[model samples]
Target: MTRHPGTNRTAQCVVCGRAFPLPKLRKIGQLRPGLHEMIAAEVADCGAESLICDEDLAHYRRRYVEKLLAEERGELSELDRQVLDSFEKGVSTVQSSAASVLDRNPTFGERTADRVASFGGSWTFILFFMGVLFAWMALNVSGLFAVPFDPYPFILLNLVLSCLAALQAPVIMMSQRRQEEKDRRRAENDYMINLRAELEIRQLHEKIDHQMAHQWERLAELQQIQIDLLERRGDTQRG
Candidate 1:
């Protein structure tokens, strides 16, 4: 937040030609005292004395990032393209949970199957059904009804059990199939997330490398500037 002295308090941007507050404009000198000269000489051609507005600065930053990525990856993937696009557009790359989105719109059959599978797999169902079977046997064998509805071998009970089994097996299988599908989708989402994260990390490394190289170059230039200044002082003092 360095303040620059100006009567009008406005500076015209070299790139866009728009007037912005002197404090708001990023002076070419302020970017990097040494590297700015190289950038102005090599890339921007602005002669080391220029001002850029926030918009143009952002544009240059994005271009720098893209250049680094291009040099590293050689070609952009769709995912890489999307990530760079998001950076340029100032949009967030993070996404909502895919599992939540998938769960939000379940069909009636899916819901029913899940519920049936959960209930059928529980100990409560097992214990209650066992109790019912015991009661049926007791009532028939004790002759509580004068004539047993299911005689000794319990043929009627066997038919009921067979029908229940026939129905429950399919419901559990349907639920398991839906679960497998969900797991597959979740794995795909996880892979995508991990890939995106790796790309971002790689891009970040590129940025850091670019900055380190730029800083090293800048340091060399600063040392040269200091040497020239000392030489000039020595000559002036001798005179």
Candidate 2:
């Protein structure tokens, strides 16, 4: 191929056999160097020394990810399915606020039940109720009323107390049920977040392992090259 004298460095893509600017191509030395040899001749006809375009790189990346998934999880779980889908789509995996999930709009009854439960379980409510009971008994005993509306047995007070207990019990129970639901939702959210984090960490480990292996191979190649050069130098000096 002919090129302008001022044209920047170009690379011949091994897959398409087309020349592109260096910026548009990735060096085999930088990527998985082993991949250059594994590449099918039909798709990429190149020797050991080759470069790949962005399109070919993406294809190989997808293949690598699939291989990892198949090896790690024989049968995909729900979390695994989600992670693989996100990986394929190149989507971000992040955790949203689990605590804030309770912010959903609640019905009037739910709100009222929560408030009533909270108040009924407080010391202020108990103190106020005790004071009212004491005042009622004092008034009846002192004969404050012309006929002491509620006499010694205070049957009216007993009836009022029973009615209050019946109503408060259900309200408190309703509030507790709602709280249990929220806790369950939070637990589910936390589990998803933790599972995703674990998957991402595993993915990172795979990438790092691949990179380290490649680096070791490259270092060995470099060391061999240096040894060959030194031998040649000694030969020349002896002559």
TM-score of each: 0.61, 0.65
Q: How many backbone clashes are present in model 2?
A: 0
Backbone N/Cα/C clashes per model: 0, 0
Could you tell me the TM-score of candidate 2? 0.65
Q: Looking at candidate 1, what is the lDDT of residue 157? A: 98
1-239: candidate 2 lDDT, tens digit per residue? 22222566876787776777877777665554345444643453455446777777656665665565678767656655555555545565433344465877889999999999999999999999999999999999997789998998999999999999999999999999999989986776666566667656766776687789988989999999999999999999999
Residue lDDT tens for model 1, 40-151? 6554446435777777776665666666668987986665665565565655554435557576888899999999999999999999999999999999999789889998
Off by over 4 Å in 1: 1-101, 236-239
| Candidate 2 segments exceeding 4 Å error | 1-101
Q: Which whole-number lDDT from 0 to 100 does residue 30 have in model 1?
A: 52
lDDT of 2: 0.72
